[model samples]
Every structure is written in C-alpha cells, then in structure tokens.
Target: MFYEASDNDHKHGSFSEVRQDLVSGDWVVIATGRAKRPHDFLQEGKKAFRQPKRTCPFENLHENALLSLSLGAERGKNIKPWVKVVVNKFPAFQRGVCSIFHKTGPYQWTDGVGQHEVVITRDHERSLGQMADLEAELAVRAYQERYRAIKQDECVRYISIFHNHGRGSGATLSHPHSQIIGIPVIPSDIARSIRGSAVYYEEHKECVHCVMLKFEKNDKKRLIYENDHFLVFAPFASRLAFEIRIYPKNHVSHFEDASEAEIVSVANALRVSLGKIFKGLNNPDYNFFLHTSPIDKLNSFRHYHWHFEILPKTSIWAGFEIGTGIEISTITPENAAEFLRNIKV
Candidate 1:
C-alpha cells in the first residue's frame, strides 16, 4: 500500500525528510522540501574567517614539536626555517598511564589514553589548497609516520587523523592545521559502517563501498577527481552541500599500508579536490577525516575501501535535524558535483 499527501493537507514550504536505507540502516535526506536559496549556503555559521597575524602562534615556531619536515623537502624552496608536524601545545590527550578500563559507580570509563598531535605547515596564511602537491604529499607522509609510531602503543585502539578548517567546523584558531586523535574505543560511526559492510559481505559476498566506487567510477556522475590510486566524489547520499569523499581504488584495509608513491598520488587527489571546493565555494570551512579498517581485524575488511570524508560547513542543524540525527542536504549531490567539476584546481 502507498500513501500520498492530498491537496487539503498539503502546505507549501521547502522542507526535508530523512529516509533510512533498509539494508545498511544508513540515513539519506530526501530533499522534497529544499528550502535553501542560493545565497543561504554561502554564509558561514560559526566560522571566524580572519585572525590577527601578529598574534598567530604558528608564525613563531618556538612551540613543542611532535615531528617536523623541512620546507626544502616539499615547499620546493627553503624560505628561512620552515617545518611541518608541530605538536599541539594544548593537546587534547597527553602521555598518561595506559588506557586502563575502569568501572565507576554503575558506569564504565577508559582513560583518554592516546596521542593528540597537530600537523602544521610553515606558512601561516596559506591553506592546504595553496600548497604545492609535493607539500601536501609531505603532510600525508607525516601522518603515516605518526600513525605507525602511535599504533604500537598497547592502549591505543584507533588513531583518527582529521583536519578542521575555519571556526564553523570547530577550529578555534585560524591557522591551517590537521590533528590526530588516538583513542581506545572504536568510534561509533566507524563501527556502524564496519557492521554494515560485514553484513553486506555476508549477504552478497561484496563490499558495498567497492560497489559504489565501481559504479561511480563507471558512471562519472558524482566524480570530481581521479588519479591512479584514488578517486574523489560527492557521495550519492551527501550529508551537506558540496560534501566530497576521497577513496582508494584498490581494496586497502589500512591507510598506513599506502606506499610513498601512492601517498603522493592520494595527496594530489586530495589537494585538487580541496582546491575545487575551496575555489568553487569561495573558501568554505570544512573537515576531512580518514576512515580505514581497524587494526584489530587481521586480513579482514580487505573488501572495505579506505577513504577520506570532506564535509563543508554549509548548513546548520535545526530541531528536526538535531532530534533525528539526520542531515538535510538542500543541494543535490549531482548539482554539487557539477559546481565542483567546473572549478579548475
């Protein structure tokens, strides 16, 4: 049986309803009531775009250092003393006792045991989009080096590397930087995705993301950038305007498995796509995070695709959105892809 709203009960205003995928239990917003006008998305909700260069902490590199890569390596020119991979002085997590699971009064908590480090570039004003491909590649290399070093710790369950740009996306400072958070618990979102992929593998003997990559690579409907090792596209079920994801074409479980050459290629893909979004959307604040197969599962999740999720801060959560935990995307992924496709990086 099917149902439709009749004219008597129908009202006129663009709104959105989120629909859940039956098989995967993932939510996708059905934009039946797309209320946003063109200019509505351009405004930054919480992003404090500009900062005083004089007070910028990164400009004077006397802070602590997790690891540093020189400018001559990637920037192509040694303009004074330049380095990447500066340790955040105010780190979220520091060297504590190993993450010992503890039982509180009727509650359980584990030590926030792990590492929190920032991957910062030399130039204070230049964002990743303004950097050379080699520079971007070096940033990725540092991520790899750090991940390898941190994962050996017994208390660490997962290491999440992510970047938040502008205040709207939760960057307290205006500096261009990325962060790595190593935690003892597997993130809830990643767990859900892993379960979904596992169920899909059991039922169909194939990974759902691989299926999507194959389809997107063939159709080119949502694709924004493609290289030998990676592909970036607006997801079929995008969470926000101009939301893009970068995926490895190969079925690699761990991002750390990526070779130096593959890392460079992935860097090019990331930089170019980010450049498109940065240019096309007029420097929208965004966040990018890496989701890879868990280290606990050995030789498993080989079917899963490792990827990066880039979510631009284009919209805010309303009551409906907050209550339901579903994002309403006004602009269709197709249209968003079209907008980015025209932008030359």
Candidate 2:
C-alpha cells in the first residue's frame, strides 16, 4: 500500500511519508522527525580525513600500469602521466577460473574470480571537483577504457566504477582515485534495478530513466545543472539529502558506447555537479558511481539508460533505515536541487 500523506500535511511541512522510486520500485521515507533545511546540511558533521602526500601510495606510480594517459606534452620522458589505471594492490577479486556456483549444504558459493583496478589521477590533492574540465575528462576516459577491457573477460558479468571521497565514504587514502571492480555475479541491487527497468519497458515500451529525465528536464524544479549532452538533477525520490544524478540527454545503455563528445559533456557535467556540492556543502564526504548495463547480454538491457549517481554524506542510517531497507532523507529533492542549482560553482 502507498504511504502518501495529505496535500495539506505536505503544505504545512508536517508530513512524514514514503516515496516509491519509479525505476527501482524501492521506497524511501521523507521523515520529518529529523527534518533539515537545505542550508542546515552545510553545518560540518565530521571533519574529512586527510593523508599526507609523502605517505600516500598514489603519489608515485611504480606499479605495473594497466593504462595511462598524459595530457601534457609527451616530448619529455619525465612528463608525469595525468591519469593512470593500475591493478588494485590488495584486490578483493583476482584472476582465476570462471565462477560457477557449487552446492554447500543448502548454501551456494562461487570463486571471486574477477578484476579490480584503481584509476589514479596524478595530483594527490586535486579531486574531481577541483579538477579542470579536461582533467576530469581524462579520468572518465580511463574508467571507460578499463571497463571496456575488463568486460571482455568471459567471467566478468558486471563492472562497478565508483569513487569515495572521504573516510566516511570508505576512502582509506586521501589521494583522489576511483576504483573499478569486475564481478562474476550481478549485484542484488543492480539486478533489481534492471528487473524493474525491464518491467517498465515491457509495460510502456520506453526506458524508465529516459521517461524520468524527460519530466525532470521539463519540470526544472529538480534540475540542478545541464549541459548540451547531459543533465544533472536531484531525483524526485532522492534517497538521501543532496543526492544528485547525472544522466545523458539521450538513451544509452552502455557507458563505453558514449561518443567522445558525450564523454567531454559528461565530464563537464560531473565536474560542475561535484563543484557545486564542494562549495555549497563545505566539501562533505560523498560517493559517486556509474550505473550501467551488465557485460553479458547487452542487447537484453537496451531499455536501460546509464547514468551517474552522487550521494553526499548527509545523514546516517539508523535502525529504521537499516532494518527496513528504506532510506530516510531529511530534505526533499526539490529543496536540495534549488539550493545546489543556485550555488555559483
């Protein structure tokens, strides 16, 4: 059953209710018990963790590099690379026999036979938000290139490309880097998202994300930023405060399929979006990840529209959230979008 409140209750700012996600069909509570104004989130919670440059592993790239890009002049041998992709020093998954589930007394297991790599930008201190548009584009290009290479492995079924900004966001090192992990199995959350999208497509014959993007673009109330090829907006059912999503204007299932122009546009969109949060929210801890179709059966997920989701560390999940599997957001997306949209980043 739906948990909608009366219009008057919402108008009075006294409503605590649940909103269903159109794509994933998951519900998130807009709990007024812990309500917060958009600006109130700017108040510092925990200080961001920092690491010294001398001790940082990414400061000097001595590991066997998988892929490297140099934006500067290539004439000199000492010209440091702008962006580099290297295998994770301590990987959660490694090369092995293809994963196949084996029975184990009412339980099942498979080998963690996949690839994990780290994408490192040259600067230890410069984050994506602080990077120039071209610099950010090279990083995104690295993610796409590595994803293309990793997906070629027959054992890889899904690849996750994500960045963690602070200790709160699971970042152990202060160096600005993103991780790419290829897995033998599809994650439950991603599987649910794809299933929901497929269901919606079967019913409406259209991409669910494209439909949402169309409305968000037209509504403008939740639109934070938009370039020629991409749009950034707070989701109508944002699961957290200051949650932002960047979507391509056109429907594209695979991130690797994006054109060079589209890549540049997305990098600009990402930089601006993160810059706004960095300036407006006092550089809060956050995590951003790319959500795209799985590697196998690409044609089956043609209805999927790939995008990036940025979730700022706004509130902690307590019992109601963790136990119920429903996140509670203190601020509404409309207000979050309005606040971020006005920030001159």
Candidate 3:
C-alpha cells in the first residue's frame, strides 16, 4: 500500500509517497520526480582503492596496545606478532559516568558512555580476505577477546564489531582493521531487529534465522559460500546489491559464546565471503558488521541469533531514500549471489 503525504500529513512539504512491504511490514519511500533506471548503476573500469603506507596510523600502534598476540611461537624464544588490539585514538564513546540519564524539557540525553577499540593486523597491505587462513583466525580471536573484556563492564548494554574496507565504506586509514564499540543503549536498528526476531520466534517456536538458513541451504540458489559451521547467502529482501549475511549453523545467541572450533569456522567463512567480493566485483568498497544478542541480558534474548552482514557500496541513497527510510537495489539478490558463488577467490 502507498501512503502519500496529504495536506495534514505534510509537516514541511510533500514530494514522495511511502510504500510498505506486505510480508516484512517494512516501509520505503518513492520520490515522484526523482527516479533512475537500473542501468545507470552499471559503470565500467572499477579498481580497488587504497592509501599509501607511509602515513598509515596502524603501522605505529604499539604504544596504544590493550592486547597483543603472537599466534605461533615457542617458549623462551622471540615471539613474532600476528594481531594487536588497541584503544582507538578517537573514540565515539568513552569511559564516563553511566549513572545519569538527564532530561531537558521534552528531550532526553545521557553521557556518551562506552568503549571503542581497534583490532589491527601486523601486515600493512593484506586485509582479512587476502590474509592467510591462520592470520584471519587470529584476527577473529582478537575480536572475541576484546568483546569478552568490554561486555564485563556494568555500563555497557550493547557491543558492536565491524570492519570497513576501501574508502567508500568509510575507512579513513589505508591499513585493514576491525573496530569494536560498547554503548550504554541498544541502537534503534538493532532493537528493531531484535523485536522482529522475537516476534518470529514467538509465532514459529524456532529461530527465524535458522529457518531462513534451512531454506537457503536447501534451495542453493541464493547461497554464496558455506562451511560445516557457517553459511553465507544473499538475503532475499536485500536492501543493496551484493548484500551478504553469514550465520552460524548452530543457534548461538552471543558472539562471545562461540567455541574455539566455531570461531575458526566463522573466520574462514568471513574470509571466503570477503575474498569473493574483492575478486568478483573488482574490489568494491564494503562494510561488514556483527549483529548479536544484547550483552545486558543473557537469558531474555535467547531467541536471537548472531550473524554478520556485508553491505557493498553498490549504490548511493538519493532523495527518495533519505525522505523515507527505504533503499532500492539495482540488482536481484539471487543474481548477485550466483555471480559471487562462481568467483574463484
């Protein structure tokens, strides 16, 4: 159904109509005047963009190290380093007073009480996708360790772990690194996802993610990559072209709850997914983030399952998307998955 801005509905002005998806109950905006054909999104000669190593910040991050690991080293010998976890020099949220949630008239706010840290690898040029299998495993281990540490603080309600590759995905530094952030409140997007998952769980008496995985595995059309423990596939209602999600076959609620074997498998799955995108799409910019159960309450969110979402910079949001919180993809997810699945990384 379409919802146009009537005289009373228009607070400022009316330029677009809102359309709701019948199945997911999600809303989207369609601008009347501004629209582009799908062919406009296809351009030629895309190259992988990277910054030079001379001015790279991650190269000199030893002093800020919160945790460092040398993957394979013998006792009583020099240890060659693999990964380092350090406090982000510029943090979005910091250590602060968590007690106050002040309200001013109709507005409510609080201190930006949180922790932000970066997981950096030793290599300057190799991203997780290009890194060796062992290096990728170590990087995943670093993410888990930092997550385990940060969630212990009583002030933290949610933790986010994500990686931004290439310039378009919002990576300022040329070197590859993942970031972990701990915040006092659950983000609106995550809250909405949790609510949806909860509703599905109550209605079906099964994990919604598991149900999706089963269908995707059986169909094999939308499937991009899969291992013993994890499955990577393009979502049926993908918000962007080449959108990928990696879910553990096991119904684990928390990222930190994954066992050692599970962690390695997840790392492998992540590596393969990124590798395929890097090779197949001519190294397009992309962002991958984790969605897990909130750290505040464990048993309450048992219905929720953790997963990774990779969103490549395939298209830019225009007026229609900005006006109404909706995105349009130029390509079908099935085709995108098939293309990526055929790529030999």
Candidate 4:
C-alpha cells in the first residue's frame, strides 16, 4: 500500500497531507496546509442575519407540500432551505404514464422513466451554513424518503440528489433548495465508480472505500468532523481546492435505505461543514451532491460506498476549464482548509 507520514506528513501543522485513493487509482492532495486549529473553526460574534421574512418564499411551504416525509411533517424549513429539498416548479423529468422501453434507430431510449422533485426549505436566503442542525436533518430525511419511493419504480436506474448554494453555485433564485433527478440510465460517473470498485473487489476481496476509511480514521489530519455514523474529510487531490467529502462508516450501497438516525447524523455534519465554509471565507458559494448505488442493479453495488461532495465556488472555470475536464485550482486545498478550519461556528 502506498503510504505517507502519519505524523510528519504535514509539518506546517493543521493536519495537511496528500493521500492517494485506492479505488479510482487517483492521487488526492489532501493538504491541510492552511488549516486552522480545530478550536478555530467555529463562528463567533456576528450580525444576526435575516432574509426579511416578507420576501421568504418558503414561509408557508404547506402551499407546496407535495410529498409527506417519513415523519408527519414536510421537508425543510425557512432557516436552512439552502440544503433542503423542494418541489421543482419546472421539473426536468416529470412523471407520466409509466411504460416500458423501446428501441429507436441504433440508440435505445426509454420513456422518460423516473420522477423529479425539488427539496425546498422555507427560506429565500440563509444557506445551510446558517441553518440549524434539525433543519439540515430534515433535508436529508426528505432525500431518503424520496429515494425510497423512486427506487421502487421498475424503470429507474439511478437517482441524483444535489444542492446548489449562492448565485455562483448555480442557484437560479436566491432560494435554498436541493433537487432529486431520478433517471433510467446510471450516470457515467456512477458507472465508473462501480466499475473501479468491482474490479478492486474481485482482486482483493475487500471494499476499497472501507480500507480508505480505516486509514483516514487512523490519521485524523484530513478529518473535519465525524459523528456516530459518518465522517467528513478533505480529499488528498481535490479537483477544486477545499473540496470536502462526507462518507458513512458503514459501507452501504444505497442512500435510499439510510435510517432516520443516520440522516440526522449526516445532516449535522453537512450543515456544520457548510457553516465552517461560510464563516471561514465570508459567505462563499458552494455546491454539494450525493453519490450512491443505482436502483437498477442495487446488489451489484455492495462494493461501492455512498458519499456527499461539497465544492465551494471559490473560482470559476473559464474557457480553458470548460473545454477541458481538467480543473485548475489557484488556492491549494490545504490552504483553503486552513482558512476554513479557523472559522468559528
């Protein structure tokens, strides 16, 4: 196994290092170079922020309570709508007559076989960074509940749940909301992840993610915050600097089956992580999304691990970035984490 210094890896302190990932065979530069001490990561005395309730669209969300959550209540609130799920006014994949597939030319496409829902909270402003733990938990529950329902569909092969915060983060409106797009075809990224894990599992008879978790746990430099069930950490080679990842300790394949308690734990970490970013960088925009096993072949994904990725909008990709998939991060993740770690929550 490729290894680095558990203690001497980050001499600049704040737990900085570049660790390699096993499954994708990609090296992640998980530098905590600029990271602040753990005690420095909390948000302190600041102006009590509010988005003027008069303009808040989510105040009376009952007007749009399309789906009931696992509990009696609806999903999301006005406080942390940034991370919650809301029904999309214009759904990309709307549900119609559920029919089978058909072949057209050499290409075969199914009857838009899935559901699309938006996870909206009761707020026009105040992102997950400013939300309460309960509010964030409520958002995660909505995702799980919706996933459970969507996966039951015979035609759905994959589901994507993602959040976009701030105008730069692709928020059409200043509202906080997440989107669930259930489609018949598994995403290319998901396929690659599954393929990588499958190949590794066949050769080693081990879950690569699990092995990474073990190493990360042992070396806590990259670890941000970990709860009873989940872990939040920065990757070694973050595509975008300060990229954060949340993973469940249990190697579960499907996010649809996540328990209520698990959701609470995840939402807590997710919110805190965002809050750290907000305070650290003075309200920077960010995007976060979930990656889980596909519903079509759920069992085959046992080798896979579900995780959430949070990418802050520190810089925009120009023409060169758009043309090529390769991203150039001006600020190293180690420095970004240093900036975030010092934030007071």
The best candidate by lDDT is 2
lDDT of 2 by residue, 48-106 (tens): 67788889988777998999987875456665549999999999999788968999999
TM-score of each: 0.88, 0.93, 0.86, 0.79
Provide backbone clash counts, one per model: 3, 0, 0, 27
Model 4: per-residue Cα lDDT over 1-345, one tens digit each? 655456446554445444445666554333355544433423344332345666666655544565644333435643222333455667777676666667888887667757788887654666777877877776788788788887777667889999887666777656677889988788887888889889989999998788778877777666777789998777655777668988989888778767777888898889889998887766667899998888755376888888899997765777866775545554455455555655668
Q: What lDDT does each candidate get?
A: 0.77, 0.89, 0.81, 0.71
Order the numbered candidates by TM-score, best leading.
2, 1, 3, 4
Superposed Cα RMSD, model 3: 7.2
Off by over 4 Å in 2: 1-14, 32-34, 43-46, 73-81
lDDT tens readout by residue for model 3, 65-132: 88887677635857454899988889999977675788999998988989999999888878888876
* RMSD of each predicted structure: 4.8, 2.9, 7.2, 5.6
Which candidate's TM-score is highest? 2
Clashing pairs in 1: 14-33, 15-33, 47-168
Ranking by lDDT: 2, 3, 1, 4
Residue 296 lDDT in model 3? 59
Predict model 2's lDDT versus the native: 0.89
Report how far off residue 36 is in candidate 4 (Å). Answer: 15
Model 4 spans with C-alpha error above 4 angstroms: 1-21, 25-64, 68-87, 98-108
Q: Give the TM-score of candidate 1.
A: 0.88
